[model samples]
Target: MFNKHGTWPMKSSLLTRNVIILSMVSFFTDVASEMLYPVMPIYLSSIGFSVLLIGILEGVAEATAGLSKGYFGKLSDNQGKRLPFVQLGYALSAISKPLLVAYVFPLWVFFARTLERLGKGLRTGARDALLSDEATAATKGRVFGFHRAMDTLGAVVGPLLALLYLAFRPEDYKMLFLLAFLPGILAIGFTFLIREKKKERPGFISKTKFFDFFRYLKESPSNYRKLLVPLLIFTVFNSSDVFLLLKLKESGLGDTLVIGMYVFFNLVYALFAYPMGSFADKWGMKRIFVFGLLVFGGVYLGMAFAEQIWVFAVLFLFYGLFSAATEGVAKAWITNISHAKDTATAIGTYTAFQSIGTLMASSLAGLIWYSLGPEYMFIISGIAALLIGLYLYFSKL
Candidate 1:
């Protein structure tokens, strides 16, 4: 029997509780974070930071999270616990949200953004590990996809909430910051309901060498290499979302419309995420991932040439579709390639590469935007996407 909350009857599998709790956690935290995300670039610009500094700050914030994900994921595996790390990450993010309201200085904003990203890094690998542990192999894609749907559901609501807050309180950005804490606190409260599982340690102690993880990955006879190379190539063109917002601003959209476009993207993401995952399960993850990459390339191309408000909005929606198809499914693919015992480590490694990709993409896009124009940034990204497609077509996964 299912509960009113739509949760299925609790069973021995990790799918039910872990997905439920993590989804709730993500939904609430996103409500808090998205409240500020759409407006952040404008806020920074208002406070006298140039586009270059904003790019640096955004890149640094994301890279910081990427850098920590593997380390914290490994730590969680070593310690054999997921809930504690998840809890800690959520709390830190919650605390950081309110800090934005209290401080107006640029450095403070940086610290707060970094803190939030750190929280994300700390929780990501462990969270994926937990989801994998709980799910049966056959249903792993569905489980993760559901979690992504839930997470995107939060993303969808967050912008709407931010829009409402801004509607009534146009002059007070701090209030939105303060209001973000509500969803975060709720997410934290629900986390205590999740049960932790015990991990079995191998008889021989694994060496803690810096490259030890990659060595294991190399030794494994899995299709990981097949997926990793293509995915990494696709990531090279996938710059930060800040560029999208900046593009919208450049096109003369108001802050309200820009945030509304973000809401539209998240709405599409939330709607299609689960179906996309289910589709992948029925077909194959590799095909879906590649298709999404191609779509993403097209979206970027559209953004490069778009001038009308409606055209830009349509591109954002397609961008959402691309994200929904790939993000959670990539994690599911990683789980397919790695052993259960090394789930966190494998996820950490993949996430690290993804972060490195973001760092490179964002930094390069920023330089392009500053030096040439926004159009060049998209053109370069488009070429990278096309190259990734060609590479993946020939590569075995």
Candidate 2:
């Protein structure tokens, strides 16, 4: 006999009720978000936004989300609640989707984009903590990995849908934004099915400063700090995926081909995320993460020289592998070393810093690309990532 809760026939320990529901929610949400992702640059360009402006917009939006992650993560811990934050966050994001096309002004576009990210900031910590609560340290890698796979699976479907729509509708970007809202609404509805165990309040009750999560570093285990430092450094070099898409477009690929490539990359990521997570559990997470960094370095360096369509295909394939290895594995490593009570706070704080680094990274990459060239930007980032990977590989953590 099988469990009645809709778990798979395989190990129930790794795929619990909450994990399944949350993954579904992420699946729907990504479908909504990614539907617009590949075409966003082209759309913005159509509307007169330059690469520099796009970079700044993304940096500011991400910084807003990052700053809030720390605060909201702390608030979730302080309140000993997760479901409310999750519900509200998804709802906000759902509403923000259609707002992208509600108006066409730059300010409105920026507002809509940042609002969606703000919703992401609000939910990330509490949601991941819920996932963390459902698994023990031994299963953390697989648990997080499975969630990522489900999430990226949405990335796969979203772009393909966009690809198909654009095939007939070509440059019909506004309608796509409206269509994306439907999946976001679906994501919000799924969140209603999620339930969370009541978390115990943290031992200390501190003042609610906006940047207070930064204080967590001093109080966290030494290993947490050790692990976070290199990760943050790497983030400073890793810009938004928009850059990659833009590069493909700049290389003279048609809109359909560019979107198709994104779909292909995400498909690879979805396929490999779960298996890589299991591998991370068996081999050390640190080792897997370092390997991912090496792959990432190679891909970026390769991207610099990639002009042919086939070369771009190979680079995207490796890019997907890099994502599969790193994203969930990094969170699992953080959660493993963190105290249970502070799980949301720990992940939130780290992600918050990562977002800040993203701002810097994207902005700098944009400036570099504008001043020098895409090749220089890629080479600098690739070399930096390789050096950081070497440092992490040799580190005691």
Mark the 10 consecutive residues where model 2 has the least summed lDDT.
1-10
Residue 349 of model 1: what lDDT? 75
Please give each candidate's TM-score: 0.89, 0.93
Instruction: Give the Cα lDDT of each candidate.
Output: 0.79, 0.90
TM-score attained by model 2: 0.93
**Per-residue alpha-carbon lDDT of candidate 1 for residues 189-302, written as tens digits (9 for 90 to 100):** 988877777666555455455444465457555687667777876776788887998899998999778877878888898888887877777787777777787888888888
Residue pairs whose backbone atoms clash in candidate 1: 14-134
Instruction: Give the candidate number with the greatest TM-score.
Output: 2
lDDT of 1: 0.79
Clashes of 2: 0
For 1-397, candidate 2 gives per-residue lDDT tens digits of 2367545557655798789889999999999888888788788888889988886787778888999999999888887889998999888888887897788799998998899999999999999999999888888889999999999999999888888898899999999989998998888888988778865666667667888898898999999999999999999999878789889999999977887898899999999998898999999899999999999999999989899999999999999999999999999999999998888899999999998898789879989999999999999999999999999999999
